[model samples]
Target: MRNARRVILCLGLALAASEPLATLATPAEAFAAQPQVYVVRPGDTLWGIAAHFLKNPWDWPLLWRRNPAIHNPNLIYPGDRIVLRYDAAGVPQLQVIQLRPKMTVSPIPSYHTGVMLPFLGSPGLIAKRSDYERLPYIAAADDSDTIFSNGNRLYVKQLGNLAPGTLLRVVRAGPQLVRPSDRKPLGHALIDLGTAKVLHDGALAEIEITNAREEITLGDRLVPETPVPEPHFFPSSPAHPIQGHIVGSLSNFPEMMVGQVVVVDQGSDAGLVPGNVLQIDGPESVTRDAVTGEHLTLPGRDVGSLMLFRVLPEVSFAVITVAKRGIRVGDALRSPPPEAPKVLGIAP
Candidate 1:
């Protein structure tokens, strides 16, 4: 018994020397609180949901990283309940409990990780306005070749320090896009023609045309390429009330169909995000009063919905997910299509 007491006294002194002077809890631990449960409402988004719990919306990754519960943290559906709780360590955690599965299969291949495409698109496409200003231009083509096509060599000028094998998109900077309602110029429509691969780099770089959707011509600008965005960009109603019109169609079609990309005048500057879904509608004339000559408007008809794939400052690229009617340029795009009018019924 005496030996055990002496050993315990010595062990206690050793443990005291090893005691930490300061203890700091992790960031998640600092967020300790009672679990706050939220029921996902119509038009709810993972981005908005994360923002609701975390005052700093951008810190959402902290709540989801390494979490075993959410396989795809970016995607969540309405009617799902999310819990914001603290663990035994007092660390905060975000989890989802779905009452029903809410995934819809899309026709287009939205994401890929296994097979490789023969070609990769522009790496520096997601860029600022300044990057577009000094874009390279096709100075000359193969000898006596007035038009550029696939596998043809292009003499490009104004190219910076691009290494060999860099990808670029052949385009024509069409026009300064302006909002019709306010005549506010947003961005220029850089019509995509095709893509090219940098063969050699220099003051005047040599590029080999890889894919030619349209006839690549001299003076055609080779702007940076934008790739397919994240798969988290799902279709959902816009967060803020939005009213705008289709400015242009990527296909240049007067009337567009489902599964096509179109440009809308509204963008991030107008409260639009990458996942926002806009309602497409068209209005018809109800009738003209015979005596007064006043015009009456028909309730706007819902044509389709556009899911944004990319968002710029004042312009966005959207895909017509569901085309109930023909989508056309100048058609109205609303956040949530106005509800259908209804009347009370009387029973005899």
Candidate 2:
């Protein structure tokens, strides 16, 4: 009987809209007194949709908790209808209805699907000095070529026992990130140079370059190629309250824009994980009170938001998802507040 009821509920068959919108105290405030439905549109993101419906967008998991069949919520595509209704106990839940069968069948999910792809191919941060020292470095190249590219042969040192055909990525150490407040060193950003395959394995290994995104040259370090992240991931707030800063960005630009990757100072040790979203705030400044003639510190303004795609011990890689203003290196990052703001024109 329970299984039958679950099947019916998954099909979005339940009580009338006249019934009280909620029975549970907490989830009641998440939705309206009447049922609501939204049509997934092109360029729509789970985070954006959740923000449109719930008071605290990070509480999105609660909306889908009853829909166990949704193996990956990120697979939602344009033209799909998301129906919000109450269960028997008057608990609010969200269900996906395939409005256009063809659209959901192996269709590219949305623009937000692979936003993290460009930043995931190389190790984002090399925080420890010993780890940087242990990596194999490009030592010599044939034909006196100082800058190497595709189809070039190079020699590497400190390469451990590895057989031919092993693939590796060539990277150069970029900026050394330091905390904006205390100037404490966090890590060095790894700039991806190119990729190579082991041609000969010995005390000094020979590698043939296959691809080059940047100029691969001597002293470029070799680290095992990192796997690309899966396109599907749900967004949520950090499990622990995070109060960190934007130490630096993956690129040389002083100001970060949307779709650019930035490095944060806090990571897994502080309960941060991939898919956790954080808001960026501009630096607080000391200002003189106009009436009191006293110095007062003003709070930073919320400027943008980013989602962590890769996390390390003391730092993590986050892609700027929303940049309302020019986000600087010293900007602050924390969980989004519990205020509800709706995105207009998102309903079907």
Candidate 3:
């Protein structure tokens, strides 16, 4: 009986020692698992490459945590090698291990030149008697035989005590201002007053209103003009367009029932072009904490998308195709991400 007891005690000790060794070996084996590497191909955007391993593209910012060389999150070139590692549960994680030389090439710089305009009401009037000195104006000829009825005549009510031969601009308000031209008053013409007249203020001025094209009217506003700078064009759209600020709106047309003619600050100079699609974003609301009396601003949510149909020197026009809610003026317009695979699990 004593010998049997001794053998049982020895077996139990051996089992306890072997159990710890087995547990340690399992984790060591997992650590030795090789990571998968993928080479980037031409025309492959970072978002595109990330999607192959990740279920969500928006989680791309998380990649920076693993790769320190990727300074600009938006910049990832072809021929770059990315590593994919799987956790013990077989969950994959992506990390940019190396960037090929060609992928690190810098892009050429583009010129940014354009004008900024305030939001104007649709069919808004340019009332007479407003100061238009040293301001830009558009000229239109009147059809009637009345003095200054022809388009050739100068009928400025805003130039106060200004001398003759002062250069002015002539612009006509129409659909062209809000569409393809994007508020850039079409057909800029120079104004030359033929005669001088006295007004109620005893100020000597040239108020001749001639209808050269038979379209000039008595109420047209006249202002000084400035030349548009060179290299004026729209900005090219990013692979993923994002929302930006809305600066103005054109609501005068009957067809514009939805107050549609809203103008945004983004344009060709900013890498935007005609036919580019953009996503409209708005501020989200968060529930207030009644006890703490604190209000939280929720993350911005996608509200709608706009398709750029017309582009101008500094502005562009897009029509809203889809809107979960009404798109308000001043909302941001941005490019949407390309269709690609997403990181399996990520926080948006």
- TM-score to native of every candidate shown: 0.59, 0.72, 0.34
lDDT of every model, 2 decimals: 0.59, 0.69, 0.40
Off by over 4 Å in 1: 1-134, 226-230, 283-287, 290-294, 337-348
Clashes of 2: 0
Q: How far is candidate 1 from the true structure (C-alpha RMSD, Å)?
A: 17.6
What's the true lDDT of residue 135 in model 3? 40
lDDT string for model 2 (1-348, tens) is: 011111212322222212111122233433344337667677766666655554444555544556677555565556666666556765444556654333323323222554555457777678776788789999987677798889999899999888899889888777788876577898798876678999998888999999886788888899887676445555677876788998877666778788777889888988998778898999889989999999999999988788887788888888786787888888999998754322212122
User: Residue pairs in steric clash, candidate 2?
Assistant: none
- Residue range 199-306, candidate 3, lDDT tens digits: 221132444432132244444444443433222122223544444665444443322222144555666677776545566777667877779979877767877655
- Per-residue lDDT for 4-78 in model 1, tens only? 110000000000000011122333442333135668665444444533453322233434445455455565555
lDDT accuracy of residue 281 in candidate 3: 78
CA shift of 275, model 3, Å? 0.7
**Once model 2 is optimally superposed onto the true structure by TM-score, how far is the C-alpha of residue 198 displaced, in angstroms?**
2.0
Per lDDT, the best of the predicted structures is: 2
Report the CA-based lDDT of candidate 1 relative to the real structure: 0.59
Of 1 and 2, the candidate ahead on TM-score is: 2
